[model samples]
Structures are given as structure tokens and as C-alpha cells.
Target: MSGYFIYASLHQGRPALEIVDADSRQVCLQWEYGHSASQQTLPERDNPAVDELSESEIQRLFRRLLLLSCRQSLHGQDEPEQNS
Candidate 1:
């Protein structure tokens, strides 16, 4: 794990955060968030991408996702939460 890039996109029609191998452009990990549940997947590897990331890096990624989610809510893209 030399370096990785984090970005936001839609995975399976839901918002997701993705970590990709900078050199190979391979998606090393994905975290898809939905209304009901969130899914995290680590692609097959001896050392997972998440393990390579520092604690600060992981925090920053989560912060970025939070900001994106807030922006979506402001723009009315996010659906209203349903009371269970």
C-alpha cells in the first residue's frame, strides 16, 4: 500500500465512500450508506486498504463524507428519515 485516494460516489444506487489504490486504480475498499443500513467491504488483499490508512486519514475521510451528506441534505437530495 503505497498511497490511496478517497472519493464519494453512488454504489448500488446509494451514496458511498471509496478508497482506491492510487497506482493501480483498483477499488480497495467501499462503504455504502443507506437509510436502513450501511455496508463495508474490503476487497481481497493480504493487507486491507483501511489497515494501511492512518487514524487521522480515516477521520478525515469520515469528515469528508459527513460534509457531502450535509450538502446533499441541504439540496433536498436526501430523503426524510422515516420513523420506525
Candidate 2:
């Protein structure tokens, strides 16, 4: 079976995301958004052309990251308005 896994956490105090192959545990992609993204990044010592993804794919990934970040930020907060 073909599968994959995604993980997100802080790396050196910066936001880090990784996509790994389930079978080989190889990281297919790694992104560190940091405080801002001023340049494009590619897998270390790897050709970016071979791993190029569509624009939509990148957008979708960004959306997921935003959602996850929001969730993490709200992890300990209380929403009294929702109680009503």
C-alpha cells in the first residue's frame, strides 16, 4: 500500500513541517516558515525539479498549515461565547 505522513512542530524555535513516506520514513518535503518566507526552499542536496508540485498543491498545504497554526494557538484559550 502507498501512504504518507505529515508532521508539524517547532524546529529551532521556528515553525517546521515535514512530509514523510510511510514505508521508508523518508522525508519528501521540509518547510520552515519561520517568522516570514522571503525565498523559496528546496530539499537539501536534492533537485527541486523532480519534487516540483503544482500551485494548487502548495496553496492547499499553506491552508492546512494556517488551520493547524490557528488550532495550536487556541489550544489553551476558552471561548465563553460558545457556551451560550
Best by TM-score: 2
lDDT by candidate, in order shown: 0.58, 0.57
- Give the alpha carbon lDDT tens digit for every residue of 1-84 in model 2: 334588989866556778775667887667664223533543343655524433444665678667645653575333333555
Q: Give the TM-score of candidate 2.
A: 0.38
Highest-scoring model, lDDT: 1
Instruction: Kindly list the per-residue Cα lDDT of model 1 for residues 1-84, writing each as its tens digit.
Output: 345588888866656677775667887566654322332444344655535443444565577667656654675645665699
Off by over 4 Å in 1: 1-53, 80-84
Poorest 10 consecutive residues by lDDT, candidate 1: 34-43
Q: Give per-candidate clash totals.
A: 0, 0
